[model samples]
Target chain A: MTDAIELPIAANSDVVLVRQRVRTSAQQVGLSLVDQTKVVTAASELARNTLVYAGGGRVRIEVVGNGARGGLRLTFADEGPGIPDLELALTDGWTTGGGLGLGLSGSRRLVDEFDLDSEPGKGTRVTVVKWAR
Target chain B: MERVPILKLGDVLIVSIQIDLQDQGVLALQEDLADAVVESGARGVIIDISAVEIVDSFIGRMLATIASISRVLDAETIVVGMRPAVAITLVELGLSLGGVRTALNLEKGVALLEDRDNARAVAVPR
Candidate 1:
């Protein structure tokens, strides 16, 4: 059975909520402390980006399991002005705002699986997963 | 508006971040710490992050920025009580917390700062 949780990312405080939820869900799946922290931190970065860049959005946290492994997945969706250059946006130290610019690239490094899709005029959806070891 | 309180301990400032900080809270902390350092003549700032369970690139950058600001005001910043998980996550997040000192706990952090102060005093011969 898969369990999922949804959180609205409307403000800075919501970012904190997303982190808490991610941490709890990661812990529920028996992920290691390090793994839990990684997912929580990644959730925070993405949630903040959803608010700061996208103005507001929603995040869905889910637990997935195959026969061999179980993992945590998070999807952040936003209807804001999307990125025009995916490559540049994924580059380290690249920011369109006054931020550290480590949100996208760093989050990708913390998880086992990463996926990002964005359109110039439509919206952006980011999905990340961390498998239990 | 949420604010992180800064407590003055002798010439050191102890900021225990218990609440999950938002962007404004972080910005407020930077401002408050900078002011406290200048107003109280603090020579060391100890930030206790034991209660902060999650730290992303933004919080990591906030720590580095605070350290930089404190240093410019002649104060050394030491981040303490970072959990093992947090340490691993921070490295993976690609934030080295450049130029920021760290300790295992508050006692060690304070001792380290005192050692630095003593060393500075000795080196200055004053």
Candidate 2:
């Protein structure tokens, strides 16, 4: 099963719309509320990052089923300032904007697999996956 | 979109979050918190995020903004009982809440609010 949804909106005011869409789609694939919530959360966080920092980004969501278990994957790509330091950005308690340094680190924990790629002055891309295990 | 009540802690008010405070939920709350804090002028505000599982950058910014806005209004802000997973996500994403205060429980948050009111009452002697 190969299905994906792509959403591109202004980073300024599109967080809720994106999260709700992801949640609805995840459920349509027969994902439980728990799994759907996790996916919704990840999508929301990534969307927020895209809007707030990157001035907006794109969300790519795909669901794949394998035998007894299925999984959800989300990729958030932003062409903003990009992260200057990946390590520092990933570090808990370390934040440049000084909010609850828990977005990415926290999102990583919610899902099963997480990957991040960013180059300064280029862009940032975050991919997260959660398996129905 | 429920209207929150005047959450009372002793003599002070503990204004629970009106917005969902999750990823996108933060947007609605973000635009409202500062003004709400000022208008309500509650001695303390407790952002109950137990129902929320995630907080993104925009949400983080809103939380920060609430706390900052409260300072001028002679009020304090406390983020209460965020899920452990959410906390970790924020830390990893580089959304550090250096200025905002957090509590393990809503009771603790209320107590803090009460204490702040007492402190102010003592200073102003009203």
Per-residue lDDT of candidate 1, residues A36-125 (tens digit) = 989888998899899989999999999999978889999999999999999999999999988889999999999999999999879899
lDDT of 1 by residue, B64-106 (tens): 9999999899999999999988998898899899899999999
Best by TM-score: 1
TM agreement with the true structure for every prediction: 0.96, 0.64
**Candidate 1 segments whose C-alpha is farther than 4 A from its true place:** none
Candidate 1 backbone collisions, by pair: none
**lDDT over C-alpha atoms for residue A122 of model 1:** 91
Compute the lDDT for candidate 2.
0.72
For model 2, how does the per-residue alpha-carbon lDDT over B1-126 read when each residue is reduced to its tens digit?
A: 444454554434465554554444445555465666666556677877776655666667777887887767877889898877667666645667879999987889878777876787899974
Candidate 1 CAPRI assessment class: high
- Compared with the true structure, all predictions reach lDDT values of 0.91, 0.72
Model 2 chain A: ten consecutive residues of lowest lDDT? A93-102
- Model 2 regions more than 4 Å off: A29-35, A80-85, A93-101, A119-122, B1-41, B46-53, B57-126
RMSD of each: 1.3, 5.2
| Candidate that would win on lDDT | 1
Q: Please, what's the RMSD in Å of model 1?
A: 1.3
